[model samples]
Target: MKKSTFLVFIIVYLFFSISGFLFPFDSDWYRTLAKPDWTPDGSVIGIIWAILFGFIALSTAIVYQERGFGRHNSEYMSLLGINYILNQVFSYLQFNLHALFATFMDALFITITTLLLIFLAGRQNRFAGWLLLPYFLWTAFATYLSWLFYSLN
Candidate 1:
């Protein structure tokens, strides 16, 4: 990948990642909730998100590289846009609005979008699909976690 493309992807992911900080995790509210025993520690959660975003950035760059700038890649871009928007909404729903069920629904939609992304990207670029595996796995886990949070509290 070109340096510029890589940088753009990184910047975009970081921009979306900023949503978490903007809304901020409500420790007090979270503390009162009935979380599962297996919930990850704060540092671990940070590390996981960092790694997942790294994968997403690289995978998206590959997709862009393969598709190039044109109307041909519109659907791919649209899926990415939807996925990114949905991804941010989860943080807002859980941390800002304190809507656990809405968070789970958003997460479920994010997972489906990620899967669609994998499939669509794979048809043209197999590496892109392979790169998103961790993202898919993490989102799947997140969907379950959100559901657990809703069910418990």
Candidate 2:
């Protein structure tokens, strides 16, 4: 992987992370709404995301290292980036609007795209795919959580 690609990924990832953290922290009005039984504690969300982001960064590095899929890497990266960006929108809709049900749709979109990315990454290197296993699992869990939240709150 080129240094530039890692740099870009870090920059973009940090931007999303910071923006998401600050945005939710600033929105107390929405936080007051009822949440499901298993809704993660906000601080726990931060911790989990930090670790997850590290895994994502590592997977990006692995994909970039795969010389065989140079062209395909860009395609996979773009797909992953689109899903990441859409997730930011999901963050806003889920929290700010309190649109629990609509948020489920966004989560579902992410889950599908994530699964696709996992497949793409696997084609490049199994390690790359393995790195994303946590992401897939987390998103899958989040999907179920969203469904529960949608039904209850």
Candidate 3:
């Protein structure tokens, strides 16, 4: 992949990462909730997301490099777009709106879409698909956490 193209993907994914800052979590509200003892620290979550976003950007760039936005690869591109949007929207739903159930559902979709992206990317580029494995695992774990939050609180 061209360095410029990869940089662009990194920039776009970084923009999506800003949602956490845009909708900063309500710490006071968060404190009131019944969280599991095993819940990760907020800083840890932030770091994990930062790493995942990097992975996502690289994976996307690889896929785009291998298969541009041609008609034959439209589904791959479409899924990327959808997954990005869904990924950004989770912050608003969870932190801003305080919608636990909705956030849980959003996380669920994110997990599902990540899996689909893995499958699709694998067909085009094995490395790209493998790159998303951490993202998929994290999202699956996140979906479980979301469900726990919804059910516990």
Top model number, TM-score: 3
Per-candidate TM-score against the hidden true structure: 0.93, 0.83, 0.93
Instruction: Kindly report which residue stretches of model 2 are placed more than 4 angstroms away from their true locations once superposed.
Output: 5-9, 15-18, 26-31, 68-70
Per-residue lDDT for 68 in model 2?
Answer: 31
Q: Candidate 2, 101: how far from true, in Å?
A: 1.4
- Candidate 1 segments whose C-alpha is farther than 4 A from its true place: none
- Number of the top candidate by lDDT? 3
lDDT for residue 38 in candidate 1, whole number 0-100: 94
lDDT per residue for candidate 2 within 35-87, as digits (tens), equals: 76567887787788788877777776677767433564677978877878767
In model 3, pairs of residues that clash are: none
Clash pairs, candidate 1, are none
Model 2 vs. true fold: TM: 0.83
- lDDT, candidate 3, 1-153, per-residue tens: 588677768776887688887888778888888989999988799889989888888887887788776898999889988998898899999888999999999999999999999999989999989999999999999999999999998
Q: Provide the overall lDDT of each model, using Cα atoms, as 2-decimal numbers.
A: 0.85, 0.75, 0.88
Q: For residue 48, what is the lDDT in candidate 3?
A: 96
Local lDDT at 42 for model 3 = 84
